[model samples]
Target chain A: MKRYFQNKSLLNLVFTFLGGVLLLFIIAPLAGMYLNTSFNSVHNAVGSEEVQASVWLSLWTSMAGTILFSFFAIPLAYLLARKNFPFKSLVNGIVDIPIIIPHSAAGIAVLGIITRDSFLGRAGELFGIKFVGNPAGIILAMAFVSIPFLINAARDGFAAVPERLEKIALTLDASPTRVFFTISLPLAWRSILSGFILMWARGMSEFGAVIIIAYNPKTAPVLIFERFTSYGLKYSVPVAVVFVTVCLIIFVTLRLIKKKN
Target chain B: MLVVDNISLKAGNFELKNINFRVDKGDYFVILGISGVGKSLLLESIAGLTKISSGEIILRGRKISDEKIQRRNISIVYQDADLFPHLTVFENIAYPLHSRKEKNIKEKVLTAAEQTGIADKLERIPETLSGGEYQRVALARSLASGNDIFLLDEPLSSLDSKSKNELRVLLRKLNRNGITIIHVTHDYEEAVSLANKIGIMEKGEIVHVASPEEIFKHPKSEFVAQFIGIKNFLRGELKALRESDLKEFSIDGIKIFSLTDAGDGEAFLLIQPDEISISNSVESGSARNHFKGKITDIARAKIGIEVTVDIGCELISLISIDAMNSLELKIGKEVWINFKASSCKIYN
Candidate 1:
């Protein structure tokens, strides 16, 4: 250790130390939340009605958002991976805009475009799908902010498929539609699943966006924030810890499935 | 019959221009070239994998140039096999036939797999198959499809020598069974052994088309000569000695004869490296042209040693290992090289 510190290449060592310090600093809050929990508080929170509602809403919305992501994002990802067209770069760049924007700004932008007065919002009114204070708005808000991860991951998976294999299928008289379903889609299914997991988790954890878009629906993140504001960290901590722990379990299970495949 | 009529295709930086050739039914036509000479591109264009920029692909006198690859009835095997990784070897061979809803799919797949000797490994995934095994699977897949036109893009390139030889025999057998094979390869020996008709491609153009024997004996141009492994060449003036009405010429300031009647100025002296014989002392024989030269180098060729003999400041003759041992030829040893006048061909 003394020799390592004395060496001139210790500059790299210094940077690595600083990075580890930063990682620990970032991880401290989550660690504290998990470590600070008492058995009584957890038991009480598990029995509470508001905590139950928040946990239920989180499960419902994340599942709905993931289903939406699979249907809407898979085709777009396939197109991005397999085809070259006009404005391809522009389209890909625009899809990733939500990933870089502030969550609050994304929520506001989504609200602006999706509120009752807007064209899409008015169109949705025909189908009785209201944005403000609704489960639909919660799902929409979560999906809007979390979709880029799914799209990009699935796109990479699809891109990794060799084009010749698809052509070989074509030569074998498999139609283009058949080829996509049989050859291209199966090869990229693992990436798409991982993307689905990411999108679901991100959507579940969304706080600022869900709060701005539809706070009344009270997904887990908003419930935690509301419980923190009205009843303090003592009241909200158990639910937050539970939600995170459940999400971790789901993430791990998805990862295991991915590995097996 | 497969007729590639005036087909031109551009793939990024390389372009196959005005490509015209015919592979008769049951012909093992090999496209021979160096890497990146657009041989693979040409085969792909013919297969409808790549769109032809111009011209018609006539198969059985039907213009199928604009047809989609699926409808073209062509099967292709790549160097890497490009087998569907998720599918088992059995499933992969069964894939094309199953997709077509062909009757007797299982029997076809098994027969093809048996022919390639990969029937036992049928249930294994592509990743589990070795290079040669994967290629055999690919070949089995193509054979199972029963497409008369087989586009092989150096399918045997990755195999070890023994497998390559075995596959060559298999390909020949397949060809004899009425598969019109357009084999693209960078290997000259593969081309020589396999091709009934060889098309030497250079810079995207089919420079020469001839039988294996004709190509080996008398290549048409410097490009064809070099591409076909003719390693001995000399730049010389074809001194047009106008004798009566008979116009004859000799190259390299050496008095030579020609069966190919010619009147020439500047020319390239071409000879098969194996045609020249080396001996310790010159003897009177059937060979007319003789030159005394010192051995410059000896390198191992497949069946024989390639001995390079330096004659004066000009000619270098490459002789065989058998000839070397018989004459006790070594580097710096003085030897007389002889070739029949018919062996020396002048290309201007």
Candidate 2:
């Protein structure tokens, strides 16, 4: 018993030592930013209209982009999970291209189709909207860079659902569409939701793509970069601290909801 | 009634060749084969879950080969009891009714649950149920669909013996209620007990289809004879034919009589192990065939002892352990082996 306890403690110590390094590496900078910032500076940053607009824009546009893209992405994910066809592997590789490339390259790729002379841009002009310097451009860039996370996660989720369950549902007089909605979708909802959360978070933090596409209506990351470049670390620290705290709260709340479900 | 007319399919590299069979209304038809013989694939093709390469499947005289699965009113139960884990037992059973927008669903679900003897497990999820209860839920779900035909893909394979017997009783009860069942199994005992008609499949082809009694009594092929536990097969040629379907055959120059009247030609003779009886004395009542043989070997069987005797040719005979002890049977001891002429089957 003594030897067993000694060995367990030694093993625990080894794991704890390695895990503590990664924990401290992540926590120390965030804690230091929050603790070192004064209340007055934080109040000033929070009260600023520009900062508030940028933060709100970041939150809602990412949420909008995530919700909008899920309609197409979830169905594609389901097809990837269940079907076999020619060029399936090619399509799967194309879905992951955005995740592998740099965000600036991804932004440039989106700009090609949505430029003023392009068909999509001309189509948008019919609705009195332009993509080059608009919120639509920012939304497009965010979705392009963040969609692969949702697709990959949701595909894995759908794959984990047993094929027999769907077959049984079909045998039970359920149409193909009905079987998908009633059996496959509900069972795979948890993973899809997680993917949604991941895409939303990644979209909010997008800097390289949003900056290249639409810099006028600044997102939180662009605003932080602007402040840091113009007024150095002292002025930018409060905005960064406030943004991190709010995102942390939102992420924790969403996780708690997921756990309850 | 269902008719699978020359239905053929290719799944991966395995091909199901021109399979033809018909299930009468309210018949317990079992397709008996070993695993990997495309039995499940055949069931899936009939249910429209998988596509057949050619030919048509007719149901109630309608060509349903092109019909969607939802339009084909056939329910299926798998061996693993693939119940929805996210739904309660009652909910799973009622899923078909809800999907069809049928009224009085709650009562129908409850009646099905009661029929499968799982009324008490209505609120439980599948993970919490035992194997038998899980299978009962699957059975209840299929039963509640109100389909006239039920495709059972070895529904009793995964259950314990006690549960298997209970499910067998339930299956018979369901059959008596006028449900046409197409059951697939590899167990000969299950095929013999539950099936009125049995089709033997080998290598993705239906080798023979016959009544269970005929399959056991007179297997038409060497594969069927060996598969159904007929241990003794002998090569012979018919010498003469007598009245009342009696025929004489020679095996290794020894004459034997059989009840099947075949033409004078080479034939295969099959004798079931249990049909041959052993006695210490030569006296017999009505056994037409008898031989003085020596006990060559003895081994323990499930219900009795299996004694091997060399009556000019090797023959296996099953006798009760009580009989074994009384006869004091031992190796190299001379004994009498007797069986009726009707017990020997001939296939050419």
Candidate 3:
């Protein structure tokens, strides 16, 4: 037993040392950017209406996108977890396609579906809504790429719940919908909630897809990129720092809620 | 009455083909089979959790194969209990009633909890309960639904022996109260102890359905014969004696007499262990089959001591503890085992 403990500690030390390098590597860039930016610049950036609008847009649109897509995505995830049919694996692979392909390509795919000449674009035009250079397009782009995270995580969550529970619920005179809402959904809430957070966070940080579909909407990430390329590190660092702070605050708050649940 | 008429289901590589069975009202029907033979699949299909490829399920003359699970009015209990982890025992029991929009959910939950002997534990969650208690909560939930028919899928297999026995008694009590039950299990003794009728399943197909006595006494196939190899089971040839109904049964060169009409060919003979009596001193009594053999082994049984006597070929006798003690039976003790000719069963 002592020998095993000694060996385990040695292996643990090696693991900690090796894994710590990547951890430090992640910390270095963010710490360097944060430390280089002045609090006065950050405060000034927060005061700017463009910064405020962009930040608010990023947060709310991402949340809206996460919530709206969840209704359909969650059911799809549950179906993936429970039932078996022909091309089921193909369907699963299609869900993951958004995650693996380039974000810009996903943006192009979204643009194709919602372009002004397309059916949804013309349909939205009748309702005084435009896809190009619009928040709706931004949400579509964000949701397109980030939905895989929600779907995969929720699918795993639903899978982790015992199938027998649903079977028993059905036998207990609960309809399929009732079993899903009462038994499956609650049991898989943790994973689904975490997936919600991840999807929202991933949507908030989106740049490539959002830029392609709606560059004028000026999400925080787009503004950061524009400022960085046009001005330099000094002008963009403050915005970057503020955006990171807001993301972290929301991420940590959601994490805490998940923990409590 | 519930009838599964020629139902067939294809689930991946396993298939339940041409499955047909029926359970009368107020009867405890058990499907006895080994694991991975589609026993649970059969129950799931019956519960409408899976779609059947062919045939129909009839419940009281109503075709229910097309009905939804919520409308089927049959409840089921699983082996692992599968209680909602977040809900208390009371809430778990009340959940089904709530879904059905039943009036007096609290009263029904309390009644079901009382029936399963979990009235006090209603406030507790399933995670805090033992295996037996967890299963009781599941059973209580089913009872709370007020369903007359129940499908239990190895509900006692996951429990300890004590819990298994307790659940068996509870099941019997529920059946006596006019509830029809179709239970699945791999344990032969459990089926015999609880089932008024038994269906033997093999490789996703039901091989035979009969009463427990008939199943044990007249196993139809080699698989069942091996699966339920009761004590003192032997395969041999039968020879007609000059006497009226007596036949000479020879098992591996050892001769025994039994009343049979298996005609004179090869046959199987079974002597129920409980039917044999053992004693230290030989008494010439009414029992036609008697042998003086040394007690080779004496072992504990579920209800008594199982003694194996090497009477040429070995023969097992089940005797009570008092009988074992009074007879002073032990290893290497000389004893006489006696059983009536009617006690022996012979079949081809």
lDDT (10s digit) by residue, model 3, range A1-261: 999999999999999999999999999999999988889999999999999999999998899999999999999999999989899999999999988999999899899989878999999999998888999899889999899999999999999999878877887878888899999999999999989999999998999999999888799999999999999989999999999999989888888877887
Q: TM-score: which candidate is best?
A: 1
Cα lDDT tens digits for candidate 2, B1-348: 799999899998677999999999999999998889999999999888899999999999999998888788898889984899899999999999998899999899999999999999999999999888888898899888889799999988888989987888889889999989999999876776678899999999998998775776678888887677756767668766644457887888678888875457876677877999999988668778888999999999767899999988888999999999999999999999998889987654
lDDT by residue for model 1 over A1-261, one digit each (tens)? 888767857888898999999999989998998889997888887888887888889877877987976798999999999899999999899989989999999999889988889998999999988888888888888999989989999999999999999999888778898889889999988888888888888888888888998889788889889889999989889988878877888889888888987
Off by over 4 Å in 2: A1-20, B230-316, B319-348
Worst 10-residue stretch by lDDT in candidate 2 chain A?
A129-138
TM score of chain A per candidate: 0.90, 0.96, 0.96
Which residue segments of model 1 deviate by more than 4 Å? A1-12, A117-130, B231-277, B280-348
lDDT of 2 at A10: 100
Per-residue error (Å), model 1, residue B161: 0.7
lDDT of 1 at B264: 63
lDDT of 3 by residue, B1-348 (tens): 999999999898778989999999998999999988999889989988889999999999999999887788888888885799989999999998888899988888999999999999999989999999998898888888888999998988888988987888898899999889999999987787678899999998999999876787679998997798787766678899884678889877688888865568776677889999987767687788888999888889878889999988888999899988777778998999899888887754
Docking class of 1: medium
Candidate 3 chain A, poorest ten consecutive residues by summed lDDT: A164-173
